[model samples]
Target: MGFDPYLAYYHSIDYGRASLASDLNPNEGVYLRREALKRYFVEYEGMLNREFIRQETEENTTFQKCFRLQTERLASCIQNTIPYIPFELGI
Candidate 1:
């Protein structure tokens, strides 16, 4: 089965229906997945920057540490989900 990220986000909320997003045509699904991944990486990069600032700041040491840990986990999850077909890929 293929996957369409936008359709999944937009249509999967309804009850008693299979995900139309997952049933997308292969080409469209791949394109949608690529775009979704790109957006995810952008957001992840922003989160990393925010986490870095939090680590550097002195306010809310405990909260900062927690956020850093959460950010790291999120980065790892995103990395794992991405297809590993390219060697020169950048975050």
Candidate 2:
């Protein structure tokens, strides 16, 4: 039998094999994923700047904070558009 990949992967497991007729709204899942990504970026930025710097100068600290903020903003933009971009998942 022919099966749609999106239905097979995203719909089948959650609603069960026979209940394909009933599917939850996709918006909630999308929102949850986006929130998770935001949390991940927050955590990642903290981890990246945890190492000691050779120069304990105010300028160095300011530069690191600015860099992390920019990186986080960029990550947020990317996550917002992730749904429009097609991606394949590996099992």
Candidate No. with top TM-score:
1
Give a tens-digit lDDT track for model 1, residues 1-91. 2233444534454565445544444233443488899998887766545522233343433434555555565456556884323211122
lDDT of 2 by residue, 1-91 (tens): 2233335324555433432333535343444488899998898778667654324342334335645555465456565754332221222
Error of 2 at 84 (Å): 38
Ten contiguous residues with the weakest lDDT in model 1? 82-91
> Which residue ranges in model 2 land beyond 4 Å of their true spot?
1-32, 52-91
- How high is each candidate's TM-score? 0.25, 0.23
